[model samples]
Structures are given as C-alpha cells and as structure tokens.
Target chain A: MEYIKEPMEIEERSFKIITEELGDKVFEEREGKIIKRIIHTTADFEFADITVIHSDAVEAALEALNGGCRIYTDTKMALSGINKKKLTQLNCQVYCLVDDEEVAKEAKDRGITRSIVAMEKALTDKETKIFVIANAPTALFTLCQQMKVGEVKPYLVVGVPVGFVGASESKEVLLKQNVPYITVKGRKGGSTVGAAIINALMYMIE
Target chain B: MEYIKEPMEIEERSFKIITEELGDKVFEEREGKIIKRIIHTTADFEFADITVIHSDAVEAALEALNGGCRIYTDTKMALSGINKKKLTQLNCQVYCLVDDEEVAKEAKDRGITRSIVAMEKALTDKETKIFVIANAPTALFTLCQQMKVGEVKPYLVVGVPVGFVGASESKEVLLKQNVPYITVKGRKGGSTVGAAIINALMYMIE
Candidate 1:
C-alpha cells in the first residue's frame, strides 16, 4: 500500500528548495548595498540606523501614513532611534507612546507625540505599516500578534530579537507566521540591525 | 441605455490628474532618489552612468546571459558602445555578427562585438525577454512581432521605452500587453530612468 501523495510532497519540497536556493544565490552577486551583522545581549546595547531598501516600501509607508497610519512610539526612543526630532516635527498626524510613564504623559499633554497608557491601544488603529524588532521573542510575538490584528499592516517583519537565545527563537516565531518575508537568515540580529531594517523598510515602504 | 463603464472611465481619467497633483504635493517631502536622466537619439548621446541603479540592470542582464540570453546590437555602432576588447577581457562568453554581410560568420566567430546578423536573430527570438528602453515605439512593435509567435511571453515585455514623444506610446504597448511590470510614473522617466526602473524591478523580483 504505497501512498500516492508522497511524490507530490517530494516534488513540492524540491520546488521550495530550488526557489530558496535560487533566491539566495542571486544575493551573492548583489552589490552596492551593505548588510551589517550584529551580536548583542539584554545587558548592554547602544546604536542606531535609518537606511531603507526596496525604495517602493518607503513610498508605500508614507502613503499609508497620509491615508491615516498614525505614528506610535516613544518620543525619546524614536528621536534617539533616528537621531532627530524632525520626525515628530513632520506635520503628518501620529500617535506617540513614550515608554517612560512621565514622558508619555508629557508628550500626550504637549501633543508632541501621541501618548497611550497601554501598548495595545497605542499600536491599534494606525495606518502605517508596523515594523517591530524586539530583544525578546515573546515581546516580538506579542507585538506581531497585535500588529497582525491591528489597523496597521506589516510590510516586513525583522525577526532580530537580540540576546543569546531570543534571536533564534524570534526567527522561529516569524517563520511560523507563514508569510512572504525577508530576514538576515541567522542569529546575528540586534537592536541596531533591527532598527536599521525598519529604517530601511520604512525608506523602501514609503 | 446607459453605459456601465463610462463612470469608471471618467473616474480613472480624473484619478490620474488627482494622483499626479497629490504626488506633487508630497514630492518635496519624499525627496526620492533621482537617477541621472539621459535623452539619447543615436547620435549626440555622451557618457553612461554606472550607478547602483545601473548595476542592478547589468546584474539582471548578466544572469540572463548566464542562462542563455545572447547580447546583441547594431554592428555599425559596435566599437563605439563600449570598449569591446575590454568586455572580452571579462571572459564569460561572447558572440558577434560583424556588419550585415559577415553577421553569420560573426555569430559563428563567437568572440567579437560587431554584429548586424545577431541583432536580427535576437530580434526574431520570441522567447527572449527583450528588456528595452528608448522613445521608439515602432522598434519595439516590430521587435515584438518579429520575435516568433508564442515565443515572446506576454508579461516579459517591460515597456520602459522612455524618451521624448514616443515613450508614452511605447509604454502603452506594454500596457496593452497586460503584463506584470515596473516603471516610473509621470515625467521622471527618460532613457536612463527607464533603464533604472528595470534595474529596480530586477532588484525586487530577483
């Protein structure tokens, strides 16, 4: 009693391997752009990047924002992340949520960034595509689920949860999502690279 | 009797205008990457760009070459296009058809650049995804039909042919073909820009 589906399964697996290998092979010849590898832990971290790729992604993100994707993030973090307050200065509407309770309130009071008491509420009803790069897989998992069901669509997910174990687990979590995505393909992602990917994605997705 | 599609036609006609205006409104804010533009008309075309955008297109061409897309051009313009001897130095593979008479011999020669016969052969291969750019719609039309029936796949036609008057028409030919493609919208497209769009698409697709 041989199973007829085995051949189909084998063929499908072969196709996937071909596609993956074919795609990876092209990257070898790809020049001009740079990809930096990073390794870090929960103990200490510092740095930033704001480059985007696939230029269209940046255009799409800006369109989404104009169409009602509200900005939601910590003011200091966002500013520190990009090294500028001009992002907040951009007239487009945004909902900021500073991680610091006091700064969050002040931002909300001053209308500098949209402030929210809960992470869930802050990330909800936004028009911009969400980009998450967490240091913990659990954090990324929670954030991904929130964005998956939230108003914002994800253009790309950077599964670079830093620290010793989180990076690998983060990749696993993203792979489980079963969507068309691009990643660094290893456990070399950290806060800087994750932010760099977002910056690049934002640039590309805009 | 009312035509059901008239409203859609009118709306689409208006949509282009609205979209153009809106794009202008945000264009300053976006400040997208601008590849150098070139308007070539056989003669008086001086210099070529070797930017990252151009790199992408060349890489794609290289891949096609690796997978059997033959290189071709008018034999009369061969020695002037690029240092042919230098190209040969790169040492992958080469084919040529010197002028109209020796074209057959040149194709048989396999290492020279001057080619009139290979141009005819390349133009006639319908299976070839002839990625072209310029203002000549007629050239593309003739090339399309000449390239054997059922050989030229529909979507393989990337109508980035861009230039003065005929560019829009060339694009329309591709549009009529109803193929998946990528092209710069509005007035930003020229010969270089057209080529750049192909490069950008190759980056995204491959």
Candidate 2:
C-alpha cells in the first residue's frame, strides 16, 4: 500500500485513518514527520515482521486487523501505552504487574488475560511465569503446579491485546502454557505487532 | 489499620476506616460519613463504599490511581490519551479502545494500551469472549467470532473499552472470552470504558 506524504502531528497520541489510493495502512506522524508506517497486506502469508519507529504506531496498525491474532511487547513504554483497558478490550488473558492480587485483578479486569504472579501468590513453576508477566515476584508454589501439570500445548491464546497493563503477564501465560507461539520482541507490541509476527510465522511455516 | 478523623464533608459515596489507638478503636475516613463521631467497633466494617456524587468523579478516581494501577476508559478517551509519556510511565494498563494492532503497538510503545482486534486475524471457538476493541462496523467481526465460539458465560470476557479507534474491538474481545467482566451500563461505553470497568472490578475485588 502507498501512503500520502501529508504528515500531521498531535500532542496527544491518537490515530488518523488515512486511506491511500494503493490500499489501507496505518501510519504514525510526529511533528509533521511520518515516523512509522504499518502496511496492511493480504493475510496470504502466515507470519510477518515489521519494524516500529514508535510504540503507538504498533497499536494503530494492530487496530486495523482481524481477530484470533496473538501479540507481544518487549518494552515497558509500549506495554504501558496500551493500558489495561486496551488489553481487556483486546481480549487478553495474561498480564504482568509489579504488585499484589489487587493489582492483578485490576489488570485482569482491564482485559489482560494473564497477569504476573506476585511474591505472595507464587505457587509453582507455571505461577512463576504468570507472576513474571504480571510483573510480580516469582513464587515456588506456582512452579510446582506447572511441574505437576506438565506443559500446556497447542495453546490457542491471543496476544494482540491493546492493553499493556498486563502484557508481561500475558506473555508469561503463553510461556507457562509451554507452547511455541509468536510474540513481539518488546513490551508495547500491539495487535498488528502480533499479527505481523504471526503473519511472519505463517509465512515461514507455509 | 487505624485512621484519625479530621472534620471532613460527608457525601453520598463516603465510608470510614477504623484504627486501634491505645487499646481503643478509633474511627477515621473509610469511605462515608456517620452522623457523629463514634468509637469504631468490630461490628463496624473496616472499609465502606462511598456513593459517587459526580460522574467525573469516576474518571478522577481513575486518574488518582493512574501511576501503576490498571484503568479502563472509553475508546475516545483511550485513543486521545495515548502518547502520554507521564501517564504511560506508570506501571498500569488501559482496557478501552478496540484492538487495532498498529495503534495497540504504538500505544504500547508510548505506554498506552488502547483496546482493539485486527481485521487480518482469525477466530475460533476456544477464543471466545476475547476481541479486538475498536470503533464500530469493524468491531462486528470481533463479536461474530465470539458468538461462533459459543461465549455463553456472561461478563467473563466482556469490556466496553471506550475512546476512539479500537473501542469496539476491545469490547468484542471481552465478549468472546466469555468470562465474567464489568463495564459501563449504557451506550456511552467505548473501548477504554471497558478498561475503566475492569479497573473498578479490580478495586472492588481488592
């Protein structure tokens, strides 16, 4: 898809659904400069990987895709940008936090499917990862639970969640599932980031 | 566990907290107000739920907990709030906005997680209740995916993430998840609104 060159900047982070003659793609502009662009392509390929100039750009791109997509974020800035609302809204089940059950619940309520387990809630190996994503301290009991349950496989978890409150926890949930899946390298990856990663993976598999 | 009382105005959404002082129970502001100062007793609940006087009070309360707490806003507000470095810096997440992978990623990078679901992804039965929160029309697909997945559980995966782009997708994700959740009661909800609801649930649960 081709993008028009008229870049606009807004102090608040927001999106503009600019349509291009070639196709529909998302772009990020800062101070009249097009810092990033997420091109929307046919999902003919399985996996795809794209670079992000700014974290917000990732979310913009992800917002334009279909469902059943997973996502990942590698940076705290990107993760927090998405927020709990975004995560919950995006149907995320995992979240990584830095606090207690209250924090975890808050993250979960915000659409973070999974959350980091706190020091107080850690129980087994599985819990360790959950806690990590939740951004909470790891515990022993959780580790034990995973050891007993064995690894969950063929995990059909979606990560393209917009909320980053529990991005860490979401990732950990996938990890605890003990399945091979796609995820963004940083913590702020959005629906498109997940889509791109999955798209890239699908390409590799195909 | 004890609180001291300074003369404060009692409102609809007010409560009180009790603290032990010199072997005697003391009453402090837990949430509401009593007609007069009374020695706190075990029969009195330690914490009380205050009646909310102003609609904006909800947003104010959310802002007060913005630092690292999970929050949910409507989609419009969620999108507008993206790229807020200071707010993003907090270890919290927003569950509003529908899933727009691009926006989701960008918001994450900016420390904002606007809720959304991409249009290029797939959906399955197991992936019920979770959706890409976003604007109208496109969010329909997200909801369809949840219905196909047999999302029977009420509120389990529901969110009304408000704000701009991915508000629909965020809410769709929650519906697909089929897990118990909370959101604003009326049409006023957006993608981020779900996040706010989730935040409230977290607070209540905590």
Candidate 3:
C-alpha cells in the first residue's frame, strides 16, 4: 500500500486491481480497454455491463489521435482528469469549451444548453476530432443533429452524459446514428468517465 | 433563455429552474436548501431522496464556517466546485490534502487510499472542522474509525463517495455513527454533489 513514486506505476496498479476485481466481466480487445479504464477511474464494476463501444470506435479513436486531432470535453473536471503530459507528448490538445463566453452567449441566444453551443463552436475547428460529451445530453444531441445535417464530421464521439432528463434519449440517438461512438447505455456517466475513455485511448496510442 | 449578465441573476435563474423542475419533490426547511442546490448542481432530482442530512449538520456547518474553519475536500474537483469567492469573504480556507506528498507517501506505505491518508492528515490540524469527502469511501471509513477511537472530532462530515464498490456500505456505516453528517445513501454521489452541499451551506450563511 505504499505510495508508488511514479505516476505510471500508480496507473498500472489501478489497472491490475481492476483486472483482479472484474476481469471475467470485461469485454475483449479495444472495448475492454475503455471499460477497464472506466472501472479504474471510478472503481465501479457496474460499468462492465453498461458501457457500449461501437465496433470501430477504438481504431477510429486511435487513428484520430495518431493524426494529431484535438480532444474536446464539456466539463473542466474531464479536462483536469486527462493526462496532459502524455497528450502533450503525442501532440494532442484537450479543450473544454463550456466556460467560453461566446458559447454562453450563443447558448443564451439560441435558447439551448451551453454544452450544445460549445459543441457547435468545437465543430467550427476542423481539427476537432474526438468529442467527449460527459455532462450534457444537449451536447450529444447537438452533435447528432449536426452530423445528421452533414454540418460536421468527427472521428469519434464519447457520449456519457449522466442524468434522468435527456441522458438516455441522447445516447439512444447516438446508438441509431452511423457515427463512431462510445457510450454508457443508461444514465450513468460523468466527466470522470469521459476523461477515462480519452486517457485509455492516449495510453493505447502511446 | 437569455444570458444573465449578473452572477447573482444566473444563480437566481438556476434556482428558479430547480424549483420549476423539482420543487414539489424537495424536503422542507433547511434540508430543502441542500436538496435544491444538489439538484441545481447535478441536474438530477434523484438526490432529493438519496441525500441524508443530520438535523444538526446545517447549524454545525454554519457555526464552523462562521468561526473561519478550514474546509477540507478529498478531490480537486470538489475544491473547484466550492464557492470560493463567498468562502473567502467569510474568511474560511479550503484545503484538499489528497495531493499532499506526505499523504501520498502515507497512503502508499499504509496500503490504503490516498483519501484515507488525507483525512488522517487533516485531523492532525485541529482547525479542520468540515470534512467534504465526495470521492472516497475509504476516507469516510477512516474518519469513522478515528471517531470511534476518539482521535478526531469533526464538526461536519459530508460523505458523498460515488461507486458500487464499498460506496453504499461505507455510507451505511456513516449513517449508524453518531457523527453529524451529510451523505448520499447509495452509489450516486460525486464531487459536484459534495460541493453543492457546501455551496448551499455557504449561501444559507451569507
């Protein structure tokens, strides 16, 4: 139980603990990576059954990361949870646009959630590939709508908005879409889960 | 839906939304204040039933705040979510000891969670009155163990650790203890929820 001096060691220990606790329950291949990371981040075994990764999501995410695409999150908590050092080494920038004044103003004007506006703004940047919508269903819904209208094309979407309101419905929409996505099936997600997925991808790519 | 220019206006609007969405479900009196804030913070009304506040917790927390007690959180996200501007006006200092090197080393040596070590360290400071544990059940369990040993006496313990593993059980143990506490009954708590309770207390004190 002594504190490990290296951050990598701590992370490895966490993964080992997760494997010991929930190894039999985890999915195979790249999807297992996302699920293990989620469990490692929250110590919640329920995520094993709840998490859904599109068949092609892991490869798509890795491709995007290797190509130096930007990662966008909806909450600062998610931003903080990501390993900036590893991402810096890979030349990937993580952005959380929820606090942007322009997004706030646009959301207010459009009578929509600020998360949705942030997604719209993120789409404006052509390099924004990975969308980590962890706190807002509106963001996921907006992303779905924009994709439907062919307004933007993202490499991968991690939609895990946790709540009773639009959470389930928004995720259901993602399930129906052809877009590459990784989501928890129900209302059981948060910024931490969102960041874990991205971090897992970063580790895989590295 | 227009952007509220003033911060107070935005807060007011947020409260209004909470009232409209879940006012009928909220508890009476001071308890309702905490519930509404939790809902406002997470956009989840389920917390109304899940959150349990000791009858003496609000008064105890207010007394400590008025006395300029140091607020200790287990995570930086909880620290960031607290209303620091208001706490600063009240001369209350906030501390998150999870990242402290001493606590980290202790956690590693003891083979316990960093949060447990952080709580142990916080107890060393007699001024640590309020324990805002939003992300770690081991911390709450450790606090309860210390209290049983008559080692540390805290004014209030906000135990809102999220996860399936040991989260509900740890909170159940807290419910049986004599310590004045505010906790979510199950695996549905987080840093935001913990911060919401503290923010509610701050607003009520203000």
Candidate with the greatest DockQ versus the true structure: 3
lDDT of 2 by residue, B28-82 (tens): 4221122111111001121122111222333434343443543333243333323
Residue B175 miss distance in model 2 (angstroms): 11
Model 3: lDDT to the true structure? 0.80
Return whichever of 2 and 3 wins on lDDT: 3
For residues A1-206, could you state the per-residue lDDT of candidate 3 as single tens digits?
12233334545666776788884674776788889878766666778988988888888999988887789988887787777778888888999888788877887887667777787788788878989998777778878888888887788999998765667778898888888899998767887788889988898974
Candidates' C-alpha lDDT: 0.35, 0.30, 0.80
Whole-model lDDT, model 2: 0.30
Badly placed stretches (over 4 Å) of model 1 are A1-79, A83-98, A102-118, A147-152, A178-182, A201-206, B1-206
- The Cα RMSD across the true interface for model 2 is 18.2
Q: What is the per-residue lDDT of model 1 for residues B42-71, given as tens digits with 9 covering 90 to 100?
A: 101111221122223334554553454433
Which pairs of residues collide in candidate 3?
A1-B108, A1-B111, A2-B108, A2-B109, A3-B108
Whichever of 1 and 3 has more TM-score, that candidate is 3
For candidate 1, the docking band is: incorrect
- Per-model TM-score, in order, reads 0.29, 0.24, 0.74
